[model samples]
Target: MTKSENTLIRLEAALERILAGEPKRIPKNRKLSIRAVEEEANLGNGSCHYYSEFSSKVRILKSKQRSSSSQQEADTGFTDFLKSKAANEKRIKEKYRSENVELKKTIQQLAAEHHLFNELIRRLKTQSKQLEVENKELNVALENTRDELTQLKRERIFKLNKK
Candidate 1:
């Protein structure tokens, strides 16, 4: 057979092997690179690059794989985004929980301060009332002393007039 005919036969056989799941005839990783095709066809390393028909066929196969691969990549990206979002939400929730705990503690402290201030005011009011009572008693004693002094002075003046 002519060299071109031989190449065509090898290329057809390679395509059949790829479709038939022949081990090592196709890449195990599901990537149909040009190298894999050339190896399957038992062609020289650069043979497929030289043949326009072979190159076009490789392009067609790769495009087909890419269409399906693109969908899978999109799904993976969405899944990663969801995972990140969930983690961020959890972090925010924990932060808020800690802040809430601190706020509750602060409120308790303020309540204690308020109670102490109220107690102090009550004690001051009681002291003020006691002072008022003492002032009233002192005023009464002073009035009694003044009356006694005036009586003594009148008695002395009457005795002197009699003498």
Candidate 2:
């Protein structure tokens, strides 16, 4: 089944069980379980107007099932619970914001380190090319010196034979 259907099924089953053997009917203060289900379905905050209406209907159904004498108590309990839940939600949001800021800082640091590493690699490659050119020049100079030494030896031999 689809995700929403699955959540609705679970909500219905839990509601049935909570109300099953109650002496004075199900308590009207069931908003917590209802909201918990919404959160589980990933629709707690961003639901459309229809979701609000649906929740109201379920709440009314719960209220009607309760004893008339207990209505005032149930209403008070629901309001108090809502206040505490609102505070809890605020704290959660703040925590998430702090974590997000830390993550962004870490990502920025990693990017900078990667850029530095790339620059180091480029400089090493350039230096290697320069060293190769210098080595080739030295080899050429050594060969020229060898040729000049050979020519001088031949000239000295000719002078000694003429004497």
Give the Cα lDDT of each candidate.
0.82, 0.67
State the number of backbone clashes in model 2: 0
Clashing residue pairs, backbone N/CA/C < 3 A, model 2: none
Runs of candidate 1 exceeding 4 Å displacement: 1-6, 16-27, 49-51, 132-163
Model 1 poorest 10 in a row by lDDT: 23-32
Model 2 lDDT per residue over 55-135, tens place:
776577656755553777788899889999999999999999999999999999999999999999999989989998988
Candidate 1 is scored at a TM of 0.62
Best by lDDT: 1
lDDT of 1 by residue, 1-163 (tens): 9998788778767766775668355565556767777788888787777678877987898888798789899899999999999999999999999999999999999999999999999999999899889889988988988898898899999999999
For this target, which candidate reaches the highest TM-score against the unseen true structure? 1
Query: Model 1 misses residue 76 by how many Å?
Result: 1.6
For model 2, the local distance difference test gives 0.67
User: What is candidate 2's CA lDDT for residue 119?
Assistant: 99
Give every collision pair in model 1.
none
